[model samples]
Target: MSDVRVHNFSISLDGFATGAGQAPDAPFGHAGERLHEWMFATRFWHEMGGGRGGSGGTDNAFAAMHGPGVGAEIMGAGKFGPPGWQDDPAYKGAWGADPPFHTPVFVLTHRPRPSIEMEGGTTFHFLDASPAEALKRAREAAGGQDVRLGGGPSVIRDFLAEGLVDHMHVVQVPIVLGRGVRLWDGLESLEETYDIEAVSAPSGVTHLTFTAKSR
Candidate 1:
């Protein structure tokens, strides 16, 4: 089956999905950049946009999921940024001049915004589309390929509660957040079990594969 998945999402050992104090200026929150330090060290991120000479292994295994059957993506405003498409003179697409994902992206938001056409096939759809609406668009856009729940903790959690995702791969970081957003918050009843498909990665990033048990 086509998947609705969260792959390689990094979180601190302390259980915080993101750091505290988020806003238009600080999207990932104070020192939240630390949350994904492992990603930056990976060759996949480097090939995508991080330039060259980066470590591989963990990031590559995680990033290998990027192209394959993955066809579309859904992200919240916090992940896409600026919240509104009010035409900031300084507005830049989420990842500098261009983003890596060439597939259509549905960005979940409360306000209506215009679409952003980036260099690649990536056209950003500003969805006033609620979580359900966003998922619908992503599924359609996916063209039977898997749709990725590409992030901001609350957004992923919402899909989890709805039992939408078929699989997931999270790369647990060594540090801890102590407090902030959480991946499993209020999701204890989801009736899912992780088979622990793999544990060791060359980059010290643990790769965990999970599913809905019966699916």
Candidate 2:
């Protein structure tokens, strides 16, 4: 079976994945680009933007793992857009016309909508299903490749709680956001089931990889 993996997920020292007051302009809210500054400095990000000159160090090494061998992606509605995006029928997504995920992307939402096919191979399919159900659909669309779990924290938490994730890479940024959406809330003793390894990069962020023990 293809593994379900998460890569380059960023969180603050306080475990907050995203900050409060998320508007159209403030995507990461009060946290701004602090959580992703390390990623932005990576060559992977620069190359994605059709640019040059970026760090080719450990940050780039980690950021570059976001894609590859992933046939589908499952992301939360929060990751799709800011709050109340469902109200706007014209809202495509936060990623403009061409999203980074060039696979079938399944969005978990209470209000499902018609799938939007973008310029690239990426297509947004909204679902009101549980984590398991959504994963089933994504796997079907994956065509025998691994499934990528794209997140904004809450969706990751839900999948973690259900033991649906096989591999996960989390980046702990050296900042403290006192108020925001947390990632570790309700997930206790998560280290037991998964083999966790931490590597501190020179950029002051720690990369934690969690691989589930043989089941």
Candidate 3:
């Protein structure tokens, strides 16, 4: 069976994955780009944007694992757009026309809409299903490859609670957001089931990997 994995998911020192007041302009909210500054400095990010010349260090090494062997992605509606995006019939997604996920992306939402096919082989499919049901659909869409769990924190938490994730890579940024959506709210003793490892990068962020022991 293909593994369900998460990569490059960022959180603050206080465990907040996203800040408050999420608008179209403020995607990450008050946290701004602090959580992803390390990623932006990576060579992988630069190359993804059709550019070059970025840090090719440990941070880059971790960021580079985001793609490859992932046939499909399952992201929460929050990751798709800001609040109230469902009311906008014209809203496509936060990513412009050409999204980075070059696979079938299933978005978890209560209001399902028609799938939107964009450039770079990225197609957005909205689903109103539980985490297990959504994963089933995503895995089938993934063909024989692994399924990437794209998240906005809450969705990741739900999947984690259900023991649906096989691999998870979390980046703990050095900042502290006192108020925001947290990742480790209800999850306790998560380290018991997964073999956890943490590596501190030169950019001051700690890369944490959680691989299921059964795997």
lDDT scores for all predictions? 0.74, 0.94, 0.95
lDDT of 2 by residue, 4-122 (tens): 99999999999999999889899889999999999999999999888998999998998998888899999999889989999998789999788899999999999999999997899
TM-score of 2: 0.98
lDDT of 1 by residue, 115-208 (tens): 7778777878878766777888888888999898898788888887777777877777787667778887887755444444758666676766
Residue 17 CA displacement from its true place in model 1, Å: 1.6
Instruction: Encode model 3's per-residue lDDT on 108-144: one tens digit a residue.
Output: 9999999999999999999999999999999999999
**Could you arrange the candidates by TM-score from highest to lowest?**
3, 2, 1
* TM-score of each candidate structure, all chains considered together: 0.86, 0.98, 0.99
TM-score of 1: 0.86
Kindly give the stretch of ten consecutive residues in candidate 1 with the minimal lDDT sum. 82-91
Ranked by lDDT, top first:
3, 2, 1
Lowest lDDT block of 10, candidate 3: 20-29
Query: Between the candidate structures 2 and 3, which one is better when assessed by TM-score?
Result: 3
Comparing 1 and 2 by lDDT, which wins?
A: 2
Clashing pairs in 3: none
